[model samples]
Target: MAFSTIKDSITFHPLGDAAIVIQAGADIREEIHERVKQLFTCIEQHPFDGFVEAVQAFTNVTVFYEPYTVHQAAHLQTHNLSPYEWVKGYIEGLLEEKWQGGGQVKRRIVDIPVCYGGALGPDLEEVARINGLTSEEVVRIHTKGTYLVYMIGFAPGFPFLGGLTEKIAAPRRETPRMSIPKGSVGIAGKQTGVYPISTPGGWQLIGQTPLPLFRPNENVPSLLRAGDEVRFVQMSEKEFFSMKEAER
Candidate 1:
């Protein structure tokens, strides 16, 4: 594996046609999340010729690009270069220059409203019972903690969040739910995530947000982006219904 540091971030050279993984840290942490966000922003603002898209994951950002376009570009074609090598070199050079001057990118924190422990949150009681905490206590801890958007995966626009309080951590259900409704808030092991679409899942359901997670018709399909901060604000069932109706 080839590794190089750019600014405070690190890039990894892995074999892949569609993308190369640029890792910011060895493990998942808030700082790493911020760094990854910064790098993503940097690339987006000053994208290379063939850049297509980026996939943000736990500790890395995978950059996807068109190899043919990159290979044929005037600035990149001089050397008989492999697509992977050319892209890697270009990113490394860009990072070294970008970080020479001192400045940091700021990430935004988003708050989502959730209604817990009712018909909306059918599994909330189960989760609370498993953790030996009262239903109210579980909601308190979940809301009190600040979560980081580590990645957007599992399904389109589905945000895999980190930094759940251990007081509410629980394993996935023995049998996965046949179909989980969209916007379902769930916890599995130490990770917490929101389901972006109606799909089958095994995560312990606790609550759900009325907001739409993925809307393909909009300019940005996903409501949440990687490297963003998320906080779940508790709402009453009435409030949830109000918000849902407002969206209609």
Candidate 2:
């Protein structure tokens, strides 16, 4: 059954009792991702009454809210509208307004430092062989491209980036590793990402970063967000060690 449409480009459907999913478009294109991000930002800035958080994926944004507070809102109570229905209407209305305003969301560029090859990148040679290129060439191609932050998932502060160069594209390992160190940079298929914290993964290990992707004490835990631009800056082993020491 058809639920509803927004801007003739997206489909909105109920996710659960406390959340709704706005499916904007198919594919991981920047235009659609930006729209989803903008809609999420708009709702965050102008939350109804019980906004919680938003989770952005490849082409959808999941909005979570407190139904109790929403039902208690004076305007909603007076209108005798169900909380879910009111939220759905409000989001659809926002989309219409944004379309009329010619909405355009700006992307943020984030630079990350990486120490590639050698011990830092154990699978560097394998990645190069799989792509039919030298280790140096692989590094050049990987670093030169500007990647988009498609979504942040798997773990807190972990960013799933897209737009990797074809020359450096490599599939994930057949057998997943038991433990991957934190700040590990990896490539799987056409996407590249960093391991925010130490955990198991199938992505081919390429390098390691000194950046703290997740810090609970900080106001903002995640270093990267959806719709952000990511660039990999090559660093030396000495530089990586120095940076790590400095952070300590």
TM-score of each: 0.89, 0.91
Which run of 10 residues does model 1 get worst, by summed lDDT?
Answer: 1-10
Predicted candidate 1 versus true structure: per-residue lDDT over 1-248, tens digit per residue: 11234444475766478588888888788767766776676677778878898767777778998888887773555777778888888777777666422345456799999998777788899989998999999999999998878888889899888889888999989999999988899999998988989999999999999989899999999898886789999999999999989986
Number of the top-ranking candidate, with lDDT as the measure: 2
Model 2 RMSD vs true structure: 3.3
Per-residue alpha-carbon lDDT of model 2 for 12-51, expressed as tens digits? 7887899889888887888777767766776776777887
Write down the lDDT that model 1 would get: 0.82
Model 1: per-residue Cα lDDT at residue 66: 88
Candidates in order have lDDT scores of 0.82, 0.85
TM-score of 1: 0.89
